[model samples]
Target: MTAGHVPVAVVGGGQAGLSVSWYLGRAGVEHVVLEAQTPVHAWADTRWDNFTLVTPNWHCRLPGYAYDGEDPDGFMTRDEVVQWLAGWLQTFTPPLRNHTRVSTLRPLAAGGFELTLATATGEEVLTCEHAVVATGGYPIPVLPAFAASLDGSITQIHSEQYRNADQLPEGAVLVVGTGQSGAQIAEDLHLEGRQVHLAVGSAPRVARFYRGRDCMTWLADMGLYDKAAPEYPGGKAAIEKTNHYVTGRDGGRDIDLRRFAVEGMRLYGTLSDGKDARLTFEPSLRHALDKADAVYNSILSDIDAFIEREGLGRSVPPATRYSTVWEPDAEVTELDLAAEGITSIVWAIGYRPDYRWIEASAFDGGGRPMQNRGVTEVEGLKFVGLPWMHTWGSGRFLGVDRDARYLADNIIDAHQRKSALESSALRASAHHHLAVAR
Candidate 1:
């Protein structure tokens, strides 16, 4: 075991972890970040080949760094994002120990924690006054229950596994989930000349455009996205709930789902009596389609107003809509891989936070750790980059910057107080021993 201690040890090297490390460096705090892979490795590896960020370049900045370039509103491709992060790391020069996987973390007798890290050569024990688990969620992918019942002859793949349209079978592909990933993946497959069927679930309410001289502009002007203090009540819960998932707003100029429907994508709702048995769209699907269109229109209206105000005519293009219901060019059916010869099933549902490495009893029945702002009930432990760690924006790229600063200040204060107490206790014990000798 290596005999050394650091003031703070951060696990995970994604956006959240890097943000914390940036602030820690600015504060001149001695710390080391442990990352199992290169920074932003998940985004670099998992996204489909045609994927681009829904958020514009401006919103993607980490703490103490802004996305450097002229095109603030330009969306970065997956590879571009990875390259930018690599460059940003060079500018900040955060002390990150790559390939060091932390196996477990336990509290020590004094105020701090002992982290067990597995390295390339051997196991190493490292202690820090505070342990920050900055592992952002989204690594573990969830699949639907019906997937297992399908015959083994059919090829199935989650959205995370999909890289491009070439991997899919020649016949129609059924894409589950209508979230940003699902919508984008379906669109990409359709572009590649494969018939695509989208399984509509609870659809997300999304903005139509990235930004313009309207509410979004106003929000940015007022610095609404900036980090803030944690003193506000109920602030933390709000921040945690703010969805970070991509949405329809990221579509480049002129693209609209209604227009895509008119051209040919099939939208299906929950299966009905015997329709699903035969792999067909449910009878009730028509009603659900109507409802989804209404939501889409509302988003489009807001976008239209913003476009006019900004005079971004060249950048913004007109959207299209399907005036009437149209049957699929191919056919919309329930996913039965074996019978239909379907090659892939993209699970665009979402991600679950896995905190198994944390053995502390601080977690509730739901597996969420109970914390007051960033402070947990357990001492010497803190959390950052959690949804709503303090306020509505707490977990946002802009929001997390604020929480990290506040958390750093609180940790510094706690460290000083604990040091003073330990010194006082040692002096008192020495005096008592001397008196006893006399």
Candidate 2:
């Protein structure tokens, strides 16, 4: 059977897809957005009830919809974020298909591409001149293989699966990994008076506010957010660095794991292995905490230097530094889970990208798409929302529009070139016919 066709097929209907659609619509490009789930479902469904954006509201800039809420500096709750995205959808009204899953995306031998989709009704095929994979980077949750060895009596959940402390059985909880989600979720449980034991990873921490303004504001002024991925200190490998942990909960604050230690929360090093009733950890908690502090202080020093260099020292608060509040006395390597009465374990390690459905030969040996600022070597194939796809903010709300605009421009250029070539061919054919008639 013949399949449906379009000029473009956008694979995800999240912010990335919507932003690209906005620009495409403005250019009069005919396209369809296929979403595996409902639009903005991640914001509406994946997050915990008390979850708020780590970044401030002003950063919520989609193509034409910038945040105009009363609280620009304040963070938006999960509900607010969902509502904000929905508002953008209403503005342009792109051709969106929810609950349509793209099972396979492969290049066509005849040109363009083919997408086999499984919708609620049944299976369908689509052919498109261009395909935009805006699925974002983090798709699959990751946990250690040892996670399965834990006692079945104890509850276990990934950070994405966690909602609140009350959902777990009443007892102490062991939260592993100190990334953004792990740190914040640990705080969530600790605040509720739950006994929390946190396994600290090497993820760095940054102060929420510095020198009379939000730390993000300081970084923005210093052009940290605008830094290109290639220009990063460690090169392309730097893009894989874990984000510095902080919090926007309770109207924004620093996540001081040290202070949490002082406040009775237990802290350990990275979790290494787990057995039926026992878990072991590497003795690196002290090193991890110190390393996080070093990054925090490094940022402060850079900002201070910027203030001095820009001659704006008097305008902002006097330069200050963080002093260690508490330290681990000794490395604690093992924990008896059953004896400690720990009823639940929350694994907040991180996520891995899942591109198994993409059957294109456009990836590197590491499975990452080989692209230059969203443009791939393969004709008419592009990716727009992966982390550090162009700049540090490429995948973020602050920069997705720029990436989309770039890709949209490329699509428009291709269309114009094709039209010109066809017109030139028509002129040549007309001349040949006239000569034959003479």
Candidate 3:
């Protein structure tokens, strides 16, 4: 085991981790980032082949960098994002130790931390005054309970494992959950000549347009794309809260879920009645569309106001009121997967934060780490990248950038103050020992 210690250590090198590292570098702090996999491997390797980011490239940049290329509005393919991150890493030059896995973290007696890390070369122990856990949530693919009951002949794969349409079974595919991933996967599978059945669930309301202009343009104009914490606190929360449910970039504008229904994409309402052998469909997809449209419009209006007040220019168009085409409660019933030949189900349900690795006992009964913004009840321990960590934007890509920066700054301030006190105490103890010896 290596005997050295760093002042600060970061575990996980995803967007959140990288953002924190970038800020730390800018602060001239010596820190090390331990990445279990190559940077952006979660996005690069664990996504569908046809997948593209719903958020435009402009909003994709980590701290200390901006996606300032020719196609700012363009959605980045998984590979493009990986390359972008790699390039950003080169520019920032954060000390990244790749393929290093952190097993556990324990608080030391002298007001610091001891980290147990396992690497390809060997195990190593690292001591640090501060540690940041930036492991982004999307680790395991969640499957419904019914997955285990399926027949052995049936093949099931999550959206994470899905690469191309060829990986699917011969028959129709049942995609569960209608979040961004599920919607995109369903659309891709349908285009690949596979019959697709999508089990609708609680999808957040979304819009096809950004502000009065396209959503992408509005995001850029409002600086939501390049937002930093402490600057636009309200804006950050909005982006983080809503970014996960956004869809419709890769397949184009007309291919949005609402538009796709008009163009012959099968829309089965929520699947119910497990006992019934029959499957039912909603008469219209309007209810879901209406809810989504309203949310989208509200977001645009907010952006428009923010832009106008901030004097950011009219890069975004004014908000337009569009009539919703929703019809009340259409009864769609059970999608019988066993009877149909559909063998795979892709559950693209959104992620929940799992902080099981956080050993501090401050977690609430709900298993959520108890934190107020980045500060926790535990002394010298802090958290970043939590949903609604402070303001609305506290956990978005742009939002977390701010939150992490704030946390890093606070950590430095606290560390400096504590170090001074510790030095004073040591000197006092030495004086007492000398007097006793004399």
Overall lDDT per candidate, in order of appearance? 0.67, 0.91, 0.67
Task: State the RMSD for candidate 3.
Answer: 4.6
Model 1, residue 110: displacement in angstroms? 4.2
Better of 2 and 3 by TM-score: 2
Task: Give me the candidate number with maximum TM-score.
Answer: 2
lDDT tens digits by residue: candidate 3, 136-214: 6345566655556555556667777879888766777777667777777888887887877776655655455544345
Q: How does residue 56 of candidate 3 score in lDDT?
A: 61
lDDT of 2 at 324: 98
**Candidate 2, residues 270-314: lDDT per residue as tens digits?**
999999989999999999999999999999999899999999998
Model 1, CA-based lDDT: 0.67
Give, for candidate 2, the lowest lDDT window spanning 10 residues. 232-241
Which one wins on lDDT?
A: 2
- Error of model 2, residue 171, in angstroms: 0.6
RMSD of each: 5.5, 1.3, 4.6
Pairs clashing within candidate 1: 239-388, 240-387, 240-388
Error of 1 at 369 (Å): 3.1
| Counted clashes in each candidate structure | 3, 0, 7
